[model samples]
Target: MEYDFTLKYQLAADDCDLDQIVERLAEAGCDDATIGVGQPGRVALVFAREGATALQALLSALEDVKQAVPSARLVEAAPDFVGLTDVADVAGVSRQNMRKLMLSHAAEFPIPVHEGNPSVWHLSDVLTWLNTRGGYDIKPDVLEIARSAKQVNLAKEARELEPRINQQLEYLLA
Candidate 1:
């Protein structure tokens, strides 16, 4: 299977030389990715990799990036975090239509990850909801890749949490 996904990173101050980073990435098994270094301290790699599963492909890319840029911090793994507009684009529907669906099915709609000005959600959650309703033409691989990206982002964030706080939150949230 070929999984399509993106991995974005925040480069360490010492690791911000774009040319060196690009050369290193190419040598580190990331020749399959389209590298983006527009931002001064950031890099985004859009990859189409082959593996048995979405997770395997994504994880391998993650590992390759880490090896190539040891000082860089993983900022996000995407197609995971998005707004209604993003979802609408992916679903081939107008933004207004997608908003209407969310409003009409507010109770059943998947919860947003952040609820403010422009709210955001996990793409897989919205896709799963649409899939259940039987009208969207979502690709299975897209859903799998989105899910895998979400997992990767969560795991990276999890590593930053204090174990004690995690335990307390786990118990309280549960």
Candidate 2:
């Protein structure tokens, strides 16, 4: 299976030589990716990689980038964070319809990761909710990739959390 995803990284000052970094990435098994460096000190790679599973594809891409640019810090893994329009596009529904569904099922709807302006959600959460609701045309591959991307992003963010915070939230949230 081929999983498509994007990985954005913040490059250390020393690793800003775009040409050299591209060469290194190509050499490091990322020849399959399309590299973008429009922003200073940032690099984004869109990949279509073959793997046994979406998780395998994402992890392998992360490892390849790590080898290519050790100083690069992951900023985000994409197809994970999104807005209603994004969710609607993937679910084959109109943005208004998605909003309606959310408003109607406010209590049962999955909570957004960020609540304000145009709220954002983990794509997988919305997809799963729609899946259970039925009548939504959710592609298996898309749902799988979105789920894998969510897991990867959460794990990356988890590395920064204090262990004590988990202990603190465990009881409160549960």
lDDT (C-alpha) at residue 105 in model 2: 98
lDDT of 1 by residue, 1-174 (tens): 998899999999998679999999999999999999998899999999998999999999999999999998999998899999999998889999999999999999999999997999999999999999988888999999999999988898888999998999889999
Error of 2 at 136 (Å): 1.5
Maximum-TM-score candidate: 1
Candidate lDDT values, in order? 0.94, 0.94
Model 2 local distance difference test score: 0.94
lDDT of 1: 0.94
Clash number by candidate, in order: 0, 0
lDDT string, candidate 2, 48-124, tens digits: 99989888999999999999999999999889999999999999999999999999999999999999998999999
Least well predicted 10-residue stretch by lDDT in candidate 2: 164-173
TM-score of 1: 0.97
Query: Candidate 1: where are CA atoms >4 Å away?
Result: none
